[model samples]
Target: MARTLHLGAFLHGVGHHSAAWRHPESAAERLGDIAFFEESARVAEKGLLDAVFFADGHSVNRTYTAGTTWFLEPITALSAMARATSHIGLVTTVSSSFWTPFHAARMLASLDHISGGRAGANIVTSMFDAEARNHGFDALPAHAERYARAAEFVEALTALWDSWGEDALLVDR
Candidate 1:
């Protein structure tokens, strides 16, 4: 089998460098604009990249002075990216801790439809007590608990997504 390297771009404001926003040519003013995001996706598509990825979190965790709290909500932004590109995949990080399995599955499934089957989700068992606190927990769940919940959540998601096959509407059952 021939080995192939898959490449994807992580879209952040201007760049990923900590000081990117400080650079004069970084176009820092366009941070939340969807056009900026679309352009990034379009470029990736032109470059024949496999996908464009967005990382998301439940809580704001950044130093105020440096201003790293720049994230457009992933699902919504990816929807826009879907419209702007034809072939490149749209992938987003979904924190399992923040969403019920059914809800997350529905959202991601819809994205797959919207993207013409190019949607992908990176389900994450989120870390950090601060992230947990925002979701009404005092502290991060125990390590085992986190993974356990994530495992169960994934099982539920798979079941939900797989519930209706192409022949699901047949009366042969």
Candidate 2:
């Protein structure tokens, strides 16, 4: 028998398309509703999805090249989704350009602990001008510079994650 592939919902506001708001099922009006996101994650869990993925960026893409839609901070949203559903993996993005390795390491570790080791971080180095401006930088960090920092950031996170041995959490006092 052929193996069946597992599916994970890469959720975006209401839906993937920027114009999904015009559709009847799209809940564009409830962008800030935690219940809306929780319910959607539950529905996906009910479908036995392998995971739910949330995209992250430092700043909103407000250029309007595509229709405007709400974008929530990924790590925070994914942490909430973790509480809403069990067994479905939670993946979120963090930009290397805007955050330090220590910050990423601590948060990801907390998420992993909270979610029972099911947390995954989608590391990125933001390159958009708007994002740079948001971080008080005059220009977007150069691609090579961003990548170099990202490499170090990931390395530091990995080291921090490994620094704690599997048995480090033993409570045998």
lDDT of each: 0.86, 0.80
Best by TM-score: 1
TM-scores of the models, in the order given: 0.91, 0.88
Which ten residues in a row are the worst by lDDT in model 2? 62-71
Candidate 2 lDDT over 39-127, as tens digits, reads 88899899998888877666678663245344677677777888898878888888899988889899988888788877887898975
What is the number of backbone collisions in each predicted candidate, taken in the order shown?
Answer: 0, 0
lDDT for model 1, please: 0.86
Off by over 4 Å in 2: 1-4, 64-70, 169-173
Q: How close is candidate 1 to the true structure, as a TM-score?
A: 0.91
